[model samples]
Target: MNPPYFSENSGCKSPDQSALIARHEVACNLTDISKCAAYLLKHSGRFCLCHRPERLCDIFEALRKYKLEPKRLRPVVQKDYQEPWLMLIEATKGGKPGLKIERQLIIKNQNNTYTDEFRSLYREFATF
Candidate 1:
């Protein structure tokens, strides 16, 4: 699904909207590293729109030979998952890993139960 932050369609003129979108999509779809490298040359700034700072450095290094600035876009720190506990962790890595460990245990248990139920269902269906 197209992210809500990006426009549903590329309609902006100054940004070369349609071309940018098409190039970005092509870059994202590319599987081969060589193809990705080629796509990056033509559409290097597209990642900036998504506010991916980590990717910016890589893009910069790639475009460096060409003397390209590769615009510095502001990082979009997603507020959707923001919580007091996450804030605490960000403040200190030494904080208890209780929540993360508990979540992992719950997920593992649920997955085990799901696998067992699926196996039982499969066996029952096979007899029928």
Candidate 2:
């Protein structure tokens, strides 16, 4: 036998129309003006890490198209910091022309603190 229709169940009065009305209700509840604006900004692809004047123009265009004021969007600047690996490389190559290579294994504890154990290897070409 074919599966029973969902509308024929005891609670459903008008299955087709009831489903449509339920969908409209869900959609209405899910719509938030601020979240919609944020989604538009993310999807525009005009505002990203490329710090160019022309890209700023494109971002302004997207803002205009969405009927949003340009002043509402604030630009955030991040300071670039050197990574530990680069620092290690710089220290290794500095004064001594031939030095040993060393590595440290870091372990994290349950309290979110770290402990390091050092290991050393000799390198003929590395500056100490």
Candidate 3:
């Protein structure tokens, strides 16, 4: 954690900069984010992402357009029966087309209780 590395800037410095662009879109949009990752990754480099479910189609399309193949996908929801508001994905640059859809992640039980795993992950937090 160096000061210069964290110095506040109006825009991102490089396409290789990960996470920040995807999370904040501060200096770019979704299209730019995918393009940046594609440019920064090698032929088989992997990219992991968590994004709003509404953007699922867009995400897939972008990845394909950039030659980043979707390899895995998982939906995250609060309850087993609830619609997923977020999705987790793993894509590989120049990877094969086969995709593995992982099991859904339910953060809470039907009674709205946090699962043991989530409780452990969010230790010391009163509410989340």
Q: Candidate 3 — number of clashing residue pairs? A: 0
Candidate 2: residue 24 Cα off by (Å): 33
* Residue 33 accuracy (lDDT) in model 2: 25
Candidate 2 residues lying further than 4 Å off, grouped into runs, are 1-54, 72-128
Q: Estimate each model's TM-score.
A: 0.24, 0.20, 0.69
- For residue 92, give model 3's deviation from the true position in Å: 0.5
Q: List the residue pairs that clash in candidate 2.
A: none
Candidate 1 lDDT by residue in tens digits, 1-128: 12112223334423576666553533342123223434554533222223123333443344343433333322222232222111101111122222221111011122234334334646766542
**Alpha-carbon lDDT of model 1:** 0.31
Residue 27's lDDT in candidate 3: 52
How high is the CA lDDT of each candidate model? 0.31, 0.29, 0.74
Candidates arranged by TM-score, highest first: 3, 1, 2
The predicted structure with the larger lDDT, 2 or 3, is 3
